[model samples]
Target: MVDKGGYRMASGEAIEKVYYDGQKATKALQALENIWVKRDLILREPKELNLSRPSNREAVMMTIVGTAAPTECKSCTKKDGPFDGCFVVPGVARGSCNNCHWNSEGIKCSFRPPSANVDDTPAPRKPTTTALFKKKAAATAMTATAAQDATTTPAQAVTMTPAPAAANVTVGNFEVLPLILPPSMTNAQKRLLIQTFQNMIIVLENSLTDMV
Candidate 1:
């Protein structure tokens, strides 16, 4: 046992010190009374005190003594675990129980007993961008080659023309003559053509009016 002064004492000496301090005055008065009654000197009985009993503060501190931090998960190296009898990972600070045989949070941890064999291989990693691109390009090239090898129908041709040329026409006999009207015929021809066309248009308009 150690005292407040940091001096080591035997267990018996510690108990004796506590017992003597607790009832020193009472024991001395009792000893004096006994001596007066007997008219003789006599040894006093040692008072005993229970030093094993703890104070309220000491009991409270003991209750919370080893609870300074949360535990961790052993499988994922993440700090989240049960309160007792479970060794956990040291980083992540929350979620899931470490003591359960199976973790329900999709962690895929099997809290096997001490005798079970544990696999040390890490989790599979996701595919890299370069690998994924290579795979996609290979698939695309295969599909393109397949499509090219497949049978294809030819497109139908189309022709268009308005009308055919006339056959058996004599090119030398086809004459283009210049106009030669007499001086007297020119005025009469103009008047006849213009006036006659105007009169015919007037007559057609009158007939349409009568029909309406």
Candidate 2:
């Protein structure tokens, strides 16, 4: 329980620790920023390092905590290397050993690269207007042909090819269409067919009676 304080920022937050003055705080803060920038890499400072004070009465305070590492690499060969932030102090949990052979964190850090932007989940696609309109147009053409067949008179309904039973229906200048059956046939076509047969029967009966 190291109790310490420094002058508060304008927001009333005391600096974490008042190391002699602001200079120490700056160094510790800068060191932390460096460690964060290089994770698993040679750290300027380790995550487990703790910079604390014993009292809060001073006008300036430092509450900086060093990043602590689990432990020093026993096989570190850079113990006598140039003194840099990456240099690790043996048996201490903060700072890192710069030697590649001794730095496990460095190997892992290579895989954890940083990025600025990320894509969100993709959205579903929609039907294009042109395709929808083409489908509708084809449907409309079929409907128009069916309707025209339903309205043809027996005189106008000339069967071009010799079919087995019923003649095909052909309009003014169009191709002959197959006849629709009674069950599946439309009401208009059915009525017209019935009327045509009835008229033909009447004419036949009257002519036969006259001849008799």
* Best candidate, lDDT: 2
The number of residue pairs in model 2 that clash at the backbone is 26
What TM-score would each prediction reach against the true structure?
0.18, 0.19
Q: After superposition, which runs of candidate 1 have C-alpha atoms over 4 Å from their true positions?
A: 1-124, 152-212
Task: State each candidate's clash count.
Answer: 4, 26
- For TM-score, the strongest prediction is 2
Give me the displacement of residue 51 in model 2, in angstroms.
Answer: 21
Which stretches of candidate 2 lie above 4 Å from their native place? 1-64, 67-189, 200-212
Q: What's the CA error at residue 59 for candidate 2, in Å?
A: 27
Give the deviation of candidate 1 from the true structure as CA RMSD: 30.6
Give the worst 10-residue stretch by lDDT in candidate 1.
Answer: 36-45
lDDT of 1: 0.34
**lDDT values, one for every candidate:** 0.34, 0.36
Positional deviation of 36 in candidate 1, in angstroms? 63
Worst 10 residues of 2 by lDDT: 54-63
For model 1, which pairs clash? 72-80, 72-88, 73-89, 79-92
